[model samples]
Structure formats: structure tokens, C-alpha cells
Target: MRSRSLFSLLTLVGLAALLLTACGGGGSKKKASSSSSGQAGGTLITVAKGAPSGSPDPQINYTLQEWQILIISHDGLLAFKRTSGTEGTKLVPDLATAIPKPQDGGKTYVFHIRKGIKFSDGKELKPSDVKYTFERLFKIGQSPNAGTWYNVIVGGDACVKTPSTCDLSKGVVADDAAGTVTFHL
Candidate 1:
């Protein structure tokens, strides 16, 4: 009777070990398979801002409708790469391919424009378009968002003056030759 009891106890222990191993292995495989399937991507993001002025032009104030239209309609040089906090801070890269950099004694700056981009009007974006856009911004007076470009480029201050003497001719220059732009301070 003692020998039979010992054999039965060993058999039960072996079975329990096998059951635990199988349970652990099974869970890991299921998790690995699910994670692989979840790697597919197709995402859209929604954001809200305090009342927008509705104008599509970032420089102009229109209405909330216009602001929404602009947000959807336009892209910038570089967008905020990320957002943080409860204020819903975000990364914003609009029309630029990369951040601008100064050259030639801080008087000249160059920017590389993103390729294969188009405007809402179906216009292909070129360095010239960027030149025109910045030119327009300067002509319109200091935008409320003036700080966006103020320190980034030179002549931003003069460009904001009323009946502005902002010498755009000497300031913003487009190098169609290289598909790059240069801003002379």
C-alpha cells in the first residue's frame, strides 16, 4: 500500500508541472501573436483650440470657420513633432522641410523645402511659394503670431512697421537654382 501511494503522488506532481508549463507557454504565444497584428497603422488625429479667427492665413484673423479651414488646408515647414500636457500641446510643422539656419554672418539664412508637396489650390510647392508666402506676411504688417518668425529670421521687426519700410527686396530671397531659400537680415 505504501509503494502504490508513493507512485500516485509522483504522477500527480508531474501532471501539475506539465499543466503549469503549458498554461504559461500558451499565454506568451497569444500575446506575441496579438502584438504582431496590432502593428498595422491607419490613424487620424483630432484637436481643439480656443476660438480660431476663421482665416486660412495664419497671419490673418477671420472666423472660427476660417481657422478650421486653414488648419486643414495648410501645412508648414516643420510641425510640432509631439504634444504634451493637459493643454494638449502639439508639434507643428507646416511648410518647411526643416528648420531654418543662418549663414554669412547672421545676415543670410537658408531653408530646404519639402518635396512633392502641393497647396490647397493644387499648386505644387516650390521655394518660390515659400518666398511669396513670407513676403505676403511681411506686407500684411506684424501678425499677431509675429513671434513665430520674429527671432527665427531677420527684418521681422521692420517688416511689422506701419507703412513699413521693410526692405523685402534686400531681405527675403529665393534660390530657385537650388530649391532653397535665403533670408538676408
Candidate 2:
């Protein structure tokens, strides 16, 4: 019992030390915010990173630093709340109307995307874009340790394992008129 208690205390100390190091340089900058500058053109926000941010592609990059930039520059179907609290971890719809309704015994998912969400190119986001986005991930297979999004879709594992032998369009359906994207798992 004594040994177990000592181990727990040591673990707690190590975790606290790591947390302190991570937050040590993240002090707030009062004069840099858009609110103070009165800039109406766009909002300016900043994030502190311990290391350089690499590629910003969601499929090509998986590091915490890359995700920080992606979250700011692009919209996901869902996003985490940006609070300085526990709620920041909770998922919220960014491009979609809400979390999708699961069907077919949790094997199918239908997402209703929001209308008038334009990309940087001024093109309105379409359901087909979602399908293309997902397909690109499998096609690129950026790194061996890529996330398993392809593994969850129907025939997606086969596509990732052997891209030449698979057809991604058969797995996802995008209805532009209905603003819906369906994933067949």
C-alpha cells in the first residue's frame, strides 16, 4: 500500500510539471487582439505553439500543431467548442446542421450540411465536396500512421489497403440538391 501511494504521488507530480511547462509561455497578449484594434475587416486571433506548425492538410498532417491551424482555416462537419473549459472538448456542428442521425443499425450515417457555406474560392460547399475530401485521404494515404477514417466506411478498409482495387464512390453518396452526404458503413 505504501509503495502504491508513493507511485501515485510521483505520477501526479510528473503530470503537473508537464502541464506547467506547456502553459508557461501561453500568457495572454492584451494589445494584439482585434477587439482592441477595432478592425472591422476581419478578426485576428493567435495561438501559441511549442514547435513549428507543419503541413496544414487534415489528411496529411496529424500533429497537434497542424490541427490548431486546420481548425482555424477550415470547417469540419463537427467542431469542438472553443472554451477555456471542459466544454471545449464537446463536439458541435461546424458545417453540418447538427450531428447526423444514424441508421441501418449504426452502419449508416446521413449528414445534412449547412447551405451558403462558401470556401475560400467563393464556391459554395457541396455534398460532393465531402465525398471528394474523404476519397483524397485514402488516395494519398499520406503516412503509414494516418487516422482510420477510411477503415470505418463500408469497403473503406479495402480501398485503403489496396487503392487500385477499390472504388470510393461506391461507398459514399452525395446529394447536392438535398445537401446531404451518406456514409455506408
Candidate 3:
């Protein structure tokens, strides 16, 4: 009897969810701009994280201010949607074309970056750029301010230790022509 009650409750919940979606829960609803706005591009907002911005190199700065600016200026391999629905909080591909599935018993992740993405310098981004970014992070981010980049990537720690002698490229395989980067754990 308890199992039957549970099943019925679940059925009703599912039906309610379906009804909400059908009623356009996921539909695009245009928002009306406020009449009081002055600028044509809307008001410019300034945010500060209560600290002075430091280090132009992204891998070196760990302060909130640095992160805030970086968040606006940079794109990552993945991103989360800002929506409040089911899509929110889910990891979606950003620079990469899609979320990579782990391979080699969850020890490897291959990312296929979108083609034609350009840097501020107007140069087209390639898979080698991603590899270089990761490598630079591990190499430059040293002791006192070394962020989590070294801890996350597979060969990051070793790369930091030997920076010159070590071949840290083992962790990242970049196929420039194919726009794919494979990270080995």
C-alpha cells in the first residue's frame, strides 16, 4: 500500500512538471526595458571586490577583484547557465563545443573547442593556445601565489617542480587542425 501511494505521488509530480513546461516555462519571454534608463547601451555598472587588482597574468592573481575581471574577460572550457530552471547549475561547454566524457576509466577528458573564436589581438584561437594557457598557468604560478591550477591538471605539479627540464606537454595533447585538446589525468 505504501509503495502504491509513493508511485501515485511521483506520477502527479511528473505530470505537474510536464504541464508547467507545456505552458511555456522554457519559452522565451522578452523583458521590457525600464523607462528611466538614460544610456542607449543601458547603465554601465562598476563592481569592485574590495581589493586592488593585481597581476595582469591570470594564473598569478587569486584575489576576488582579479577573478571578477577575469570572469568578464575570459571564457573557459565549460560554463554554467544563469537561468533559474533545470538548465541552471549544469556544466555546459563554453569555449569547447561540448562537455567531454571521461575516458580511460575516467582518467582522460577530451575537449573539442569551437573553431573561429578569436582573441582580443584578433588572432584565431587554436587547441595549442589552450595547451599553452594551461602550461603557462602551471609554470608561472609559483609557491606563494600558486592557485589550484597546479592541483587540478594531471602533470601540473611536476611541471612546476622542473619547469625547464620537465616535459609537461604529456598531460595535454593538442591537435591544432582538429581543434581538440585532450587532458590526461
Ordered list by lDDT, greatest first: 2, 3, 1
Give the alpha-carbon lDDT of every model.
0.47, 0.58, 0.56
Candidate 3: tens digits of C-alpha lDDT, residues 26-106: 223479778895656666768756556666455555556655555455666665554778886555556777767667755
**Worst-scoring 10-residue span by lDDT in model 2:** 15-24
Error of 1 at 37 (Å): 26
Regions of candidate 2 where Cα sits further than 4 Å from its true position: 1-43, 47-53, 143-147, 164-166
lDDT: which candidate is best? 2
Q: Write the per-residue lDDT of candidate 1 for residues 1-185, one digit (tens) a residue.
A: 54343333222212111111111111122344555356657886676666654544555553456544444444554433334574333333334455544456445556675565554344566666656666565566645544344423456566666415454555567776677766664
Q: Which candidate would rank higher by TM-score, 2 or 3?
A: 2
Clashes of 3: 0
Ranked by lDDT, the better of candidates 1 and 3 is 3
Tell me the TM-score of each prediction against the true structure.
0.52, 0.70, 0.68
Per-residue lDDT of model 2, residues 67-154, tens digit only: 5665565566666676878987665666668766556655566778778766544567788877776666667766333234345566
Cand. 3 Cα-lDDT: 0.56
TM-score of candidate 2 relative to the true fold: 0.70
Model 1 per-residue lDDT at 6: 31
User: Considering every candidate listed, which one attains the maximal TM-score?
Assistant: 2
